[model samples]
Target: METNLSATTAAEANPGTARDAAARHGALGTLALMIAHCAGMVDVVALPVWVGTLIGAYRLDPQQAGLLPTLFLAGAVVSSLFFSPRLNRLPSRVAATLGFCVAALVFFGLASTGRYPVMAALHAVAGIAAGCGLSFTHGTFGRSRNPHRLFAIAGLTLGFFAIAFLGITPGVIAVQGGQTLFRIFAGVMGVAAITSALAFPSLRPKRVAATPAEPRFDRAVWFGMAGVACMGLTQAMMFSFVQRIGLDRGFGFSAVTATLIALGFVNLFPAPIAGLLELRIPGRRVVLAGPLVQAALALVIAQSAAFAPYAAASSVLVAVMIFTHTFAFGMLARLDGTGRAVAATPAMLMTGAAIGPVLGGTLVKQYGYGSLGIAAALIAAMAVFCFSRLERRPN
Candidate 1:
């Protein structure tokens, strides 16, 4: 306890020392964070396959299928909102291990159930637990010496996981059904639980002197969070349906699955590339371009009847989000000195995502796939407006 206080005192005294301390545990810290990133963001790769499995194997309509993942993301958003502010008071490893353990158990339970109500409840439980763990992981990342580079490295790790997950899980679900998919989720949470227990670095929040003044986020932080949420919405809305869109358009199952694999391969480059270009490019320029590019890709994927256009657009859509969000993440970490704002990463991300699948399902049911492009355009406009409000930063 005395050592913790001393470390905290020193960290509070010098910001550079805090960053260097985080780097001192670099290898183990990075690996733990990588595993946590894969575990927390599993939804990115899992959602499409998950929703499709519910539709095909479980015999549900698009709305019902979409609702499950929405429930999971909503649960995450709620849990993140609750945990982000309290992270400093908690023991990082214990909190993370406990969260992942509960999530693992809930996922195992998810594997055993086919009932919609049961599965919905389990997903919410798993999301809450997983979100808690992720809050710790991202908060620690924000405390690092070079958060952008560290986050990019973690993003690269996630890209690798995406390839393995996208390559394997869909085929397994096609053969074995929803049970296999839930079991895979369980295994992921279990691994996260184990790795966090063994390797999570010591993290002590910087001490703020006691005062009557309230701690509040700057206006810019809210704008950044809003921008990320908008992008998240567009991403989930389009991605959740890409597989179904391709298949419904008479693209063969093999071709559609191949596109998913290709999407994974495409994902591998964006993060490292973003990391390398960090100093060369201004993040605001990237931020300004992100939503527009994302909207265009959505337009192409949604309106394209041809297999070639659809595949091409779908393959690279996620890479845009991954790349743009890396810059956004770094910028937010810099803007919010307390780390509390960046700790709300799960909330900022999953809040829009929570609404996306269900909203897309409703749109597809009511209008058609083309309506998604219209929606993306509208959301992108809002994201652009929000990002425009961001204060410029020097490289």
Candidate 2:
């Protein structure tokens, strides 16, 4: 009799409870956004590895090699400003799917093209696609009811995709050659894009009721930009030069790549933890702490003679770096409280990413790899200063 009564009560509660659950899950809308983010990860993971090899194969100088990644980031920055806002007006699913398809095509073209100029152009196209993907995915997911969970899912998805590509791409290139790998990647991304397009919900655009626009040049935005810029510069430097650091330490190509891949693996698990941490701790504090930790690790790696210690330090550095940056993103979304504002965040981020490598490469030419640690430390200190100022401002 008691069991029957309990069942009846649960059944009576089902409709309201189920609706709440759906709201928490963000229905189908959140899944669509996650898929779009996963599609973008395919390129972000693969590009650094490819860039290193492409530079060697072309026998380009460091400056010339640096230009390739810079151009790619430049495209992202420009497209974010021009294309991202427009995507909000289009059907979200279609815009995201089309962007992924375009990126896949460009990736395939890049693999096929032998000439440096042609490859560079395709990379730029890929960057534009990346900008669109990032913009739309952030916009869609940020607006979801359960944004923190969605962001965590997005970060984990990106990290796993990165690890998979970093682990597999080199072996695939060795066994099947670059062209075949490109074809396989393109096909895979194409399928994902198509599936995302089909599975996404028909979302009615939310009306933005007119209000006084916030001042464009706010102190919060500038401080956020500085922190993001510092992180980007650090990442770009590490991405561009970590292999060289390994090689200089007498590690083999496979070992160097494996160490790099390990960083991505570490990244896979930390994002959700970072998201949870953001809820308990202040975002500025987390962001400030990350660079200090990274700088310390970089110094250890720079000075370490043994491969094991260097690899361990490097991996931890990257893991923490990603964790803090992902956390910062969540905080940015919280602060913005709108999809468009979140979409705009990447544009600010790309500016830092674009400049970091070029500057790092120049530094390398002038002072060599040993200077990288010191430079990173200084940049982190600057980020700390920027965040400190922002923290003092009245909300």
Candidate 3:
């Protein structure tokens, strides 16, 4: 409490210039944070692309290849544990800027590394830095007066990037090879460092953790974390290996790939709607509805023989997943104004993602797609139950 006061009081006391500057920073900070996420996402997007490159270049087997992202996610989850809790306690500007700088430097090193052991180490370190950056970003989003809209914008931005990823990654891989993705990542990091340094103060206020706005954790807080974690678990499990499911269905590789690509449209459309509906719609309804729809759709997507139903099921699955996250995240921001629960967002997401492939792969290998689909449906049903526990608020 004593520590929190000094930092926030100092900012509150300097009302004129600091307030004016801080006021101007909101949108700029959002942009910086969003772009930083876009840049930091090399961990998520580059894995499949670069994994093949790593295998060919290093003569590594599939299991050895799997270690790349596993260690990277491990680094993120561990670092977020240590770093996210400090967002309110520490100087926001310094924390965010320093994180971006660390990520930039590590990614630069990632570009230059050649040895398999050394490259893995660099990627792991880079993941830690990226996790810190995300913690700061999520922490920033947590404090927004309208977290739903903010997260929606972030989701829509990701949607655009998903489209760009489809177009750009393939071209880069074809022309420049996989190492170029690291170079691109390094450049994105450098830009994020600069943007965060310039706009960090606008991101969020230097509010004290002990302030009335941020209360001690309670059932609602834990419930919110559990909800998002369940959300992450279901999505990652099926979404990670969805293409394999498509292939197993006997769909042509081109048709399956096209359906997968088409699914990107959901991110562009429904994600923003989920954000907008935060103000107009009750969070519980959207939250419950999202997984309900996903559960029904997942059953079909996991098993349907007809290509048309498969495509439709996959599209709706994508839509509801994004919708669930957008509204559920908004509900989290509302529950704990202090954003502590919100700070756990990335951890819940990355941890679930890290677990998904392993579990999905194992289930598919053992029992078949029917078992995997049933598993996804069950998890999605769980998310519905968990999200229902949230304290209902009027729209």
Best-performing candidate as measured by TM-score: 1
Clashing pairs in 3: none
For all predicted structures, in order, the TM-scores are 0.95, 0.83, 0.80
The lDDT, on a scale of 0 to 1, for candidate 2 is 0.64
Per residue, candidate 1 scores C-alpha lDDT tens digits across 266-360 of: 99999999999999999999998999999999999999989998999999999999999999999988886556677789999999999999999
How much is the lDDT of residue 343 in candidate 2?
65
Best-to-worst lDDT order: 1, 3, 2
- Which number leads on lDDT? 1
lDDT of 3 at 355: 61
Model 3 alpha-carbon drift over 4 Å, by segment:
1-26, 40-67, 104-120, 174-176, 202-214, 247-257, 365-370
- Model 2, residue 379: C-alpha shift (Å): 1.7
Q: What is the lDDT for 83 in model 1? A: 87
**lDDT of every model, 2 decimals:** 0.85, 0.64, 0.65
- Model 2 Cα shift for residue 50 (angstroms): 2.4
Candidate with the larger TM-score of 1 and 3? 1
